[model samples]
Target: MTDTALDMSVETGAASYGAASVKDYVALLKPRVMSLVVFSGLAGLIVAPGHLHPVLAAVAILCIAIGAGAAGAINMWYDRDIDAIMARTQKRPLPQGRMDPDEALAFGVFLSVASVVLMGLAVNWVAAALLGLANAFYVFVYTMWLKRRTPQNIVIGGAAGAFPPMIGWAAVTGDVSLASIILFALIFFWTPPHFWALAIFRKVDYSAAGVPMLPVVAGEAETKRQMLWYTLALFPIGVAPYFVGVGGPVYLAGSIILGGLFVLSAIRVLRSEDHKPAKQMFTYSILYLFLMFALLIGERLAA
Candidate 1:
């Protein structure tokens, strides 16, 4: 090859190497968190009073999953600096320079808009509106406004995560109801204890990153105190679907047992000095939410 041709070949190779892999784009979605969002959205669709066509239901879930991914990518784009400082998030695609910030931001915005539009076309506009609102809240409210400003950031921002069930319910019924609101309440209350557990262990990271997570802004003792309170509040709200007769006895039983365990875990965190309870709480909280929703799904299927 001539010198100019060799130079062109070298530049092309470098560009190819610098391009983001598919896996990197997927990682920008925060797929593990997306899994939970998808599952919860599915549970909402299943337990709602009306029926949706299976194909449309799948679309609804897909939109929710994509919307979640979009919001997460936006969050990653905005938080790249702090993300790089935090040990737990330091390996993410943006922090590692696998993708440009603008690329991630555009990817997130595209997914966010596409997901809402798809939901509106395939399902109902109600669901689409809720999805749009959730994405907006996560991006504009939580990520931009509240995240760096307050210790109560996640507390208020938790509502953004709590909207999936309502969206799912709206997918089927085209309207919200008391049951859907109760489902929303379940997640809203659970968010504090669940995330505070993680914040307890990740306090150093939050501190170093200059993010005022509860454990970073308040003392651990106060954070533990709040976790226990939220867990207590969650107990009644979580089991409400059963008392409302939407779920059968099986659900009621599971809710009581799981809720008791969650409260106990919070109590342990409060009483102990080690991070073990907080760590355990963080791990089990995921299981707790999953099984709690599973009970509602199981009862609906069985009925």
Candidate 2:
């Protein structure tokens, strides 16, 4: 699991790869995470004041999804060494010796450029720029610079994930606005507690990979405390649109309920040492973001 061991295995993996399939390439994209990004981006597009043609709207979402996938592929390529050491990631194509890292990197770069260029041609340049920035930030800033260097990596690196909704908003409006920025803030503040909850239970995985996640670098107690703090901050950001007259009573009420449950889960994580609470917190956090975004989109449709 050490760096030297990882290097040795990676060299072996590079020499002998199997006949990898299309599915393995898709797996490199981190499709589940990209789904969330697409959904949130769509929600932003739906809530924005202007309208986009149905075809263009679909294209916008497609570009966003592809950009996210490109970033994820690059991340996987860069992290393959440590990924082989982690239990959850050991089965990944690169780590499993089923795909070459160079191939993954090339695919990632190809998709990254194509997505941005297509977005610019079919949609607006603003959206394309945001997508490019998000890809760059995730690949260069978060993956290469922060992941191995700092415990607060997710805090700052989270800005990369936060760009999707803004990109969606910009696609329709051709400009960013307070509403879209609020959407961005909501996700930015939500990232820390969400990832930290996983880190709490996956401390051993991070330690083995030598990644400096909060729990691995800061200890469980500090990480738990920070989770509570970030969750508290996230609740207000989640509900901010309601106060700003962007979201309605339904969105307001739903966010309140969801945020309350999120905080309660965070409290459980804070108060308990059992892995059960952290696992529960991680599950609820995903539901929390999904439901909150759903409420906003539903409110927009109802209006």
> Each candidate's TM vs. the true structure?
0.95, 0.94
Model 1 scores a TM of 0.95
The regions of model 2 sitting more than 4 angstroms off are: 1-18
Q: For each of the candidates, give the backbone clash count.
A: 0, 0
Model 2, 1-303: lDDT tens digits are 798986886677643565578999999999999999999999888988888999999999999999999999999999999999999999999988788778999999999999999999999999999999999999999999999999989999999999988999999999999989999999999999999999999999999999999998879999999999999998889889998777899998898889999888888888997889999999888988899888988889888
Q: Which stretch of 10 consecutive residues in model 1 shows the poorest summed lDDT?
A: 9-18
Name the lDDT of candidate 2: 0.92
Model 2 TM-score is 0.94
